[model samples]
Target: MTSGSEFPFSPDPVLSGTSDDRQHALQLNPQQLLDRIPVTIWQANDQGQIISLSARWQLITGRAPVDSLGEEFWNSVLLEDRDLSLQQWINACQQQRPFVLHLHLCSIRGNSCPFLIQSEPLLNDTDQLIGWVGTLQSTDVVIPLQSKWDYTQKFLQALLDNLSNGIVACDTQGVLTLFNSSAKKLHGLPLCPIPADEWASYYHLYQADGTTPLPQAEIPLYRALQGESVHNAEIVVKPSQGKPRTILASGDPIIAQDGQKLGAVVAIQDITLRKQAELELRKSEERWQLALQGTGDGLFDWNIVTNEVFMSPQLKQTLGYADHEVDNNFEGWRQLVHPDDLGEVAAAIEAHLRQSMPLYVAEYRMRCKDGSYKWNLARGQTKWDDNGQPIRMIGSHQDITRRKQAEMELARLNRDLEARVTSRTTQLEVAKNQKEALVVKEQEARRQSEVDRAGIKLYESIISNIQLGILVWHSQNLESVDHLELVSTNPAAESILKMNLHVEIGRQMSDIFPSFVGKHPDILLSLVEIIRTQQPRSIENVPYTFPEGDENLFSLRAFPLPEDCVGVAFENVTCKETNEPAFS
Candidate 1:
């Protein structure tokens, strides 16, 4: 045989396409690549004689390549001592199968080294065995590669052991292959090599109650091993050295592509704290229910974001509503507010929600289920989120209709007393005027000057003390433009119009009530007409808005006075009109 025998094998390819293979190739040629690796590639004929060997074989054995051709190649590398590995190789060749053997090779320098020889029979296109091809790897190269793999496995194991959740994995035979640190902490014991039947007892597994022992079939890991996917299987662990812990377990079976069950894995989470919190919440709810029953005040809890409200039974009853009468929402609650009081209630609630007020409080009226309205004293506080947005509100309602009725009655009595006092005062003033007139009549025959002084004093007293606002306007025609100039005003007129008549005495009447010109031109026109015709005219319920935005309704009577003047008398009637109940 020659060193370069023409064999049927093709030249080794330069690795391509894949990143890993290209990285390993390092741009070396086929012969150079074979020599760089820590193995010798060889080819043999059907008769078990070496036909060709790679250039690395001489480097590995430190011998001449041509001298080791044919049967001498095997004899040169194989130890003089016959081994079972050689016999196994012979048997594999006869059976035309693959084999792996461990043997010792001696170099020309008398150095001995252990090596692994793996060989597979080469088949022709027709599936007939043609020859054999194999690799001989030195133990120095094999050992380091094996150590690399072992380090990688240890790194993965440590990573799993440091996780917070417990992990457990088993092989197809139910042998516990992996039980991490969290699992040991939960079980209070190291991994037990017991069979599946005794796993529950060995690991002290129990039902979710923590008292009853769990059966092997009910164990989450065992069920997963049987090709079942278990999720949220709550179990209790009663360790010998620790308190019982509740765990939520989820697991799944590991299956191969061909549907073979390879193993199973399970993850466990501790839920003891969550369970305790749930129990406390249940107890707290019971106490809250008791408190609601003891206090008869109507309670309302509102979620501002969702606009949903929880109306307690007392709240519904206070409004004369059944369970299904009112919708449980913010809009429904707003719809029941009395229209006259809605603005006040809304402002109070908004102030509290914006944190401008410590708490919301407003007295308003709410329409009842029976189509009547009742006074309600509502007080609430808002809860704000971290961003200072109102999230929730809780409030109580108190029925104050009786108290409001009492207040109204007391107010009406006060008005009545005031009216009676005014009527009596008017009668006294009339009697005093009559007495003064009689005195004037009687004294006119004796002292004319004294009668004149008495008459002037009477006129001034009536003008200053009367509640009706009185204004004297002198009609003027300046440059053919008609206007009224205010000449005089009583104290009542100054207070009612919120102006200082002394400062405004000579100002035009149009300037004094400028706001009324556009909206109520009839008031000014009537005053001019009364002056022109010298006839009395009356205007009732004339709406007037002041410069400062205060609004009122006034009933006015304008009559012609002497010297081109008009006398106007007006009284505020806003309250009387507003207090009258509506018919529809």
Candidate 2:
């Protein structure tokens, strides 16, 4: 028995045994040994004829070892590599050395198996090659490599065909190697005779700002070729005759398995819409500024969380503060508010925030730099977030100090005028009451005079006993003289004078009759005569008439009473003639 280590070559136990045993193993052949070795092995002669094959080769090729022995073996080789393989085998046989080959072997299952073959020339002692001994190893592990290669080719073709964005692949030298369908479509070119590095210059791509052509240094593809990965790099490209195009580009370095840089893959997408939107936003901001300038109201915006205030220039001017003097914060406003009005101002702001309504009016005193406080009418509205929390406030402030002062002055004037009117009304009311009292007193005094005059006439009638009328007069020159009451008398005056004789007896003449001069001219002359002579006088057959239209003949005698009142007694001459005619 020979151990494997004792043999220089691993010899088959059956082959090395005695002649009888060898003959027995030769009948079994290398085909049986190959199948037992778990690998398929075969040998072909110098003329590309199969000399022998293991059982696995027969099983894989679906042919017997004897059937594979001649030109039939060459026919069994895959047709694509058969001719080349045959030449290589002949060369190795001529050199009388070992050679290696990789070939696709067809299997009965219609699948192909890859194998590595190592062959050594079999030589006699005379140095002449007799046959070849080859060993075959199954290469099933290489199946994955072939599968990956097929999938990569399909994946790249699909990627280039279906991509929406422009894709270009270039070698490290900037020579265009691959251009996708989108890249062709973007430049309005066909895929035939795809453009190379000349495309870079022929397109004449410039930046959107019209500054310059896209420099290789700034291009994502160029950066990737320089061994850098670029992501979302923005670039603008302008053609020679059209509007500029904005693109967001990305690139990555393509490297071989051995870390050798091959080229770069670049992806570019149009971004013109995004840039246009940004430009519109800037214009909108400008319009907002213009609007604020047009309106006269002082505008302000305040952030609640930050407590910062943004005021337009007009707002600062309205507050009587220099632009720099007004601090851009709520604290500045709070400090400027009059101490007395601070609470009210705070309440108004809080109410607006809580109610989420516009505060149309709030009046407060704002201290100016000159140390004077002016009234300001502030109106504000709270801006709310989606959750109804107050986030910002916008408002206007108006200076109303002049108007407020005018209103206050008007109120004061009104109060003063009301007081004056009340005072004048009191004086007028007192004067009116006093005048009424004087008029009442005058009426009563006149009534008393009539009573006194009647009394005087009655006294004269009783004492004289002569159906006489008495007329009393006031002495004009004497301030203390009694005045007359009787304005006129007739024959019927005797009875009327008798009624008030007692009351008129010793009264002052002017006291008894205040209107004597206005009533009679004759009585006034009689009173003057009596007062001048200081004597009694009589008049006979004087005609007198009463206010009632009755006539009488009277003898008048006038005498002075106390206080210079005249007592005038008139006797009816008709009765006197009747009574004293016989005696005459």
Best by lDDT: 1
lDDT tens digits by residue: candidate 1, 60-163: 67777677787576675555433334444554577677766666788646787767878878898899888998888788676767667668989999999899
Q: How many clashes in candidate 1?
A: 0
TM-score per prediction, in order, is 0.41, 0.34
**Lowest summed-lDDT stretch of 10 residues in model 2?**
1-10
| Candidate 1, run of 10 with poorest lDDT | 575-584
TM-score winner: 1
lDDT of 1 at 571: 74
- Model 2, range 1-584, lDDT digits (tens) per residue? 01111111334646666899778776764334445666655555545455666666666778675676666766657776575555555544655667776667676777766767788776678886666777776667545587776689799888777988988776544555566887665544432222233444565545556467666576677778788899998776665555667787789999999997767888988787789977996775444553453355566778897999877777677667787998889988788889999888888888888884466358999887788888877877887777988888877776666556655655564565566665687665655565455455545554554554455455445444534455645444543323434433334344743334345544544455444334555656656667666666665566555555666565666665444545566556655645332112
